[model samples]
Target chain A: MINSPERVAPDTLARVQAEIERLGFRPSRAAQSLKQERAGAWGLELNSAGFGRLGAILDTFLIELTTGAAERGSHVVPFTAADSAEPLPAYERLVASRVADGFVLTDTRRDDPRPAWLEAHRVPYAAFGRVWDDPGITSWVDVDGASGVDAAVRHLADQGYERIGYLGWPEGSPVGDDRRSGWVRATTDLGLAHPEWQATSTQSLPAACRAAAGLLDQLGLPGRSARPGRPGRSGPGVAIVCASDALALGAWRVLVERGLEPGVDVGLVCFDDTDIAEALDLSSLHQPLDRVAERVLHLLATGPDSRDPAGGLLLPPELVVRSSSKPAGNRTTRKEK
Target chain B: MINSPERVAPDTLARVQAEIERLGFRPSRAAQSLKQERAGAWGLELNSAGFGRLGAILDTFLIELTTGAAERGSHVVPFTAADSAEPLPAYERLVASRVADGFVLTDTRRDDPRPAWLEAHRVPYAAFGRVWDDPGITSWVDVDGASGVDAAVRHLADQGYERIGYLGWPEGSPVGDDRRSGWVRATTDLGLAHPEWQATSTQSLPAACRAAAGLLDQLGLPGRSARPGRPGRSGPGVAIVCASDALALGAWRVLVERGLEPGVDVGLVCFDDTDIAEALDLSSLHQPLDRVAERVLHLLATGPDSRDPAGGLLLPPELVVRSSSKPAGNRTTRKEK
Candidate 1:
């Protein structure tokens, strides 16, 4: 009845569309692939360096993406680096060999040569991360890291933690920079910006712990005065936000070693809600990789011919509030033995 | 020089052959593939159930295998389950479509229908796990879990831990059963067999922790006694072996909660030397996944034409000795706060 143009009114059409959107109706991809002669696979070009120490976010994302692809009656064809410096040959071969219908590019950076190469060759691709320079070249799906961190910082402030600190990766890393930029935005907006409180380190548990310890030690000293008109509230309610779960885990350990209660004395927010966070019951920003995969698959299936200029989708991350971020006296905060 | 039959003496040829064997020369796969008209891609059929949790072993193996394949100028084509119970359609399509030269099978079980299906269809395939029904049906590369656990048990006994318990997954898992068999063999041989001391639980950290605590509390109470020859040792030296790193991590936490110092009052050994083992400094059995990948790739490249009766390779696992396996007197173990 809804499909009949003669009987269905404009309001009925709108209501049906709204219901479909609310219910998240995805068309059967197996049937769609059969109808369109789809290759039923998408190629993913992985960085060789990532294989050394598998990133938890990337590992989980891959699993979710594979599940998403399998649900859609498709699969992800992984192609690794032949030459790390020059990966164009492998990309060219993938196109020439017809192994996959399209590609999904991950770990996108500023001035990334991949989008250019893909544009020049007119290969169908959907990037998982955004490129800085020619946004019109390809469709992409990126988690709004800046917004995620911005929300995380605000949440910390709302938890009554005034002296919030941030631990992030070193400069020049686009991904880390994006996350830090969010913290910057939040700190500035909240009137809690502390230049001495910010720190950077390599993305390892040990390195992050050291950096976090340095930040915490330097945070609540005599030289660091309380805010104007707000005495005796300088650093007792300190909070720390990390760019990743690894850094947060490190900070948690440092806090424990320093005899400061994590959830009561210091609020902690971690990006990437991996298994570690779950095990430790830490608050974290969870990226919706399943939705991202769905959107990326949609763009890839649309192909290059139908490429739209404003096709980039920036999805918001959900904040999972656990015991780690609860304010003092909150029953949700679990006591450490 | 050995190529020249007329100029080279027989003794010289023999010496050169011995040197070549010592050097461990592997022929370039690119040249071999070119001469043989290789499809340049291998198929991997992944189960949907495995995708749910994304086992760390499988994840690492995939990365290593993909890297190995890329180094050999080939790529892995992963075809996942469209139907969980019936995966042959996907395999049949891969063959009918000529998208892959051969397949690599993982997580093989008793009376697995896949081997028989491939055999009847004349599809070239190599398994990563052993098939119990007929060893001669196909080539396989398996990690010797029995030997790995046997070595772990002996190492614990050597560490002055007389009563070594095993925490493993519930019955019906082949891999878990294999590891338990090793423990049983070692316990029976060492006269420390206590049937009630063994416990089984789910593979999660919390479940394993609860199970570990139960085993520890129920042990050495009344019924369980020290080995007949060892009258001096009662319950002084107690240790545990886990089937995986997750379980080991749980056991460590339980030990800590009970105020017992790990690597001091208790010994721990985990299988799969993943990041957790390194981060926690627990001793583990490291599987030779790189070598396994090498052997699997070799069998795949050989195709079904060169199927040998005794082609199965069961590689022994290497146990890495760390502070966790060290005896109480050893000062090498780092003291926890």
Candidate 2:
């Protein structure tokens, strides 16, 4: 069996180094070779576990980066992650031979081994999402989910919906937590007394829909805490901000089944304006796919040191007010701004 | 600069050959290093744009094949051909890096430069789709589109519509011809005269919709046919089979705008039940994505030389009966079946 790098003989390393040199790469050998060959394409390794929204978002982000880079002449390579989602063997081969130029890691856990693997190999990689325990050495692009929640909250408040609710994936997800933070911030800023159980999360969309139902039950609009409903803005209207469109759509389906018109009876806002959102006219925060794609590619090609980029590029997402979430007074909001 | 085998200096060749021996590989040490480390991933360097349905079918077939391999402990890597639709530089890297365990090529054109490239580089591969001229090659899998089209025609005939038209891509597309041939043969078997003017291919959906308007105006409902006084098949229902769902949806949109319901007024069938098709509730040929993904992996891991599985594989598609296409019965061959 071939030994690990630790057990590789000195002479063998020298010979491999010489072989690598003959490949027309510099002495930084493995690193230089990898860096030089980086412009070809991105090789992402992922597996499908049915409804992988996180996977979808990460993939979309990665592809956008690659597409953007391709416009500038670089390519993106999609390498499916092994079933285990462990890429050690793959990494060893590529690093040893200086194959992939760079990488973009996604679905990073709190103590992600992927970022460390790339870091230790001196590989130039950027994480699609961020890691909390990151060593400050890794570069990553993340969504300002908090801001999205805030937008939803402000819209709901303007529409005179005092009792708004937030629904989505478990807080274990970094993004979910960020979104929740924004929700809390917005409610606190408006001096609204948010009930402790007004928010909920679940793994599946059906589960999320169920949770939304429960939240609505707990925060019943008929309780009459705030009287005198305004035109198109008052009543027991509830604003639901979801982490993803699938969840949001699922909620909308439930509402419709119960004879409640989404965007009218209950304002619904979902993230990621995927095609489904457009067909249903579900209001969403439009993530600029084109711009994101370009940025990802630029970082991969130009090098990680190219500049951290402004605010790390939190592309402003447009609050597309559709039937789900009305405007600030014209249709849904309390006052016209 | 590094030179090809023919242009290499004898001394340099000998030195490289010696290094290759040291690495337990042949020729360039780089290639040997890659071949020695086989990750459970297969590489497919097929053209995405020009490859045709044959290419897409092979892709679906491969996805099916790969699922099994993955289940058996292996993953497949999906990659596209270069912009020029060739793999010279891309293939070079794939070969030397041992990126894919084997090569699987789809949509192999008649004058394919890929086979030659593979042969010159000693890469092992399989073909899923093939150009008709390569009759002697036993390395491919092809779906009998003629039969598929026949089934579609028969299905349409079972319904009560007469007056039919074929929505197809350019004839150069292998699968397109196969399906069109099926359509024509079905009509012939029914002893009905097929009209050439009924077929059409536009640059895009909007164009197709515009053309559809004209077709509808000319072949108006039973009593509305341009040839006045002659009553067409009661209601003179029409069925359109688009080469792709995108086009089918476009046609459906046009019909709806003109106050015509798809399944009720006119029948439609599309190929490749893409995402849009499912939500739109349109009938189509369901490409077995799971089976295809599984099969590709299986062929890559077990069928090919495992050194380079960049060949093609074709999987059968399923005809999903939706409301869009009426049930056949007394339907005229001119209408559909």
Candidate 3:
């Protein structure tokens, strides 16, 4: 009678409504969920490797996702899989118990079991990374790493850095390869391609530093030049475009050790404008995480069946320039190369 | 009858159990929650400031909390307040709607409204940081920052660093002050007290670098000494104990710019062994996040009504000795003073 006011007499409806307002009555979410057969919550699998690290943007994405869910009168239930490699059991448990209406997937990689399993079970899910194994899958939103890296290279070129080197993760990872392609495309477009100027290393700082050192030597940085006899590449107008902030930190450390100022000596740019970049004053590409989160939640809300025909969205990252990418004329440090 | 097998006839129960097993039917969490008047979920408010930074440990804590909650058959529902300062409304909404049975609070500070508001409303909540305003409130589990800093100082001192200085945040924050007190206590205890050999800055890199330079100068580190006349403190056997990895990065940068290799030239130790510390190989205090999460879950499970007679728990962080704090004899870099 309270819900269907039309079934009750006008006087009774008014009295009951007034009493409810006076007593501050509110419906229980669990009871409502049961009646509607919806959990009103989304499961988010927290794979430890995705967050809690340098240059990690997933933590920021989580904040955006949580904030967005709240605005839509929903909650994000974070859970960890017992076995990260075999996460289907965790997903299945949530589904069986009806603890979540759907899931928000992240760290989507090649040959990942999640998308295929979720699809087979008719589970509603949306990923923050591309559905790498299946281009047919459209329930995802990701940053355009290739374009972001391309922009970084172009930005470095514009800053008067002639010999631009690339520092990136070893090939084979989809995301790393995608970002590397951008550097390739940008340098080729500018007719300044120096393929040998690049070097690869794992995400570790020591490894990054070693790779960066070798790359610097290849680019004809004085004192440690690997090919000192080679001509035309030796100069102060050199810059390095790194795939991640962690890699850029390695390059930055090499510059500091050589008593060379980053912007004043060698221009530097990196992807993922994380705290490391901000702290060290390095120019980096900033992913549109808020928009990505909004799109992901949209995909989750309007299941994969109702996804857009255009397929997964790839938003371009914005380049955040700091002192590291500034022209040499604006030198602040007194270090002489 | 399915749940209480003994209440039914043996034949009927056997048949029902077989059918249930065949169908793999499980009790709906939402329906169960409605019946029991429990949400079986804990709310975690993710303030942007607490995580996603150079020296943040909250992200790690979140992962640990999520894993611990899952083990206890509970979900951690992450949410964001419309106004972080007045977050009671968000908590109230969760309570009134029965979305969560309790909350796991983080970033608890003095004069925080959540503790008082939750206590008055009789809401079950446990904080990751101490309830600084009310000593009687014992629903928290915190890393003992003072003890952690004290250990770092002693560790640096043990590594043969004679002129030990501190780089910390500006005074007023309870956590910052606690850590600073540790430095003071340890330095005084070891008869190496140099009250003026310290500097404070906000958690920004540039500010930290400036402050660290000043502290290093006061400690008589080479050419930049503030008082050239001051005799006893000049040389390579100096070290800095930073309150956080972020601050340590700043000090590290200053040291790098002056061509001084860490460990070989100056010992360094910091708190919150975050990725920044790991990347730079800085020795730091690692908070027992897994243990902290376990304890926080325990507090939330055992509500304030049946709380322990003892006060809130303070777990000490372990000092992770990396290359940054090694003795000067292990010199790798060829830089000369």
iRMSD per model?
9.0, 10.2, 3.0
lDDT of 2 by residue, B155-228 (tens): 77677556567777667867677777877888678754355525455435555655565555555542223344
B323 Cα displacement, candidate 3 (Å)? 1.8
Q: Kindly indicate the candidate among 2 and 3 with the higher lDDT.
A: 3
Which is the winner by DockQ between candidate 2 and candidate 3? 3
Model 1 chain B lowest lDDT segment of ten: B221-230
Ten consecutive residues with minimal summed lDDT in candidate 2 chain B?
A: B50-59
| Chain B TM-score (model 3 vs. true structure) | 0.93
Model 3 misplaced regions, further than 4 Å: A222-236, A330-337, B222-236, B330-337
Q: Which residue pairs collide, candidate 1?
A: none
Arranged by DockQ, best first: 3, 1, 2
The per-model lDDT (C-alpha) reads 0.74, 0.58, 0.87
Ranking by lDDT: 3, 1, 2
lDDT of 2 by residue, A1-337 (tens): 1225557788888787687678754222222223344324455544443212321344344434543644564444444445435667655544443335567665666766777777776777765566567646537656677887788778777866666777767767776787778878888898865746455656454465567666656655321123333223345567777777767755665564344556666777888775446545677877765665665555566676664644345555667767677733446334210
TM-score (chain B only), all candidates = 0.80, 0.71, 0.93
The lDDT leader among the candidates is: 3
Native interface contact recovery, model 3: 0.93
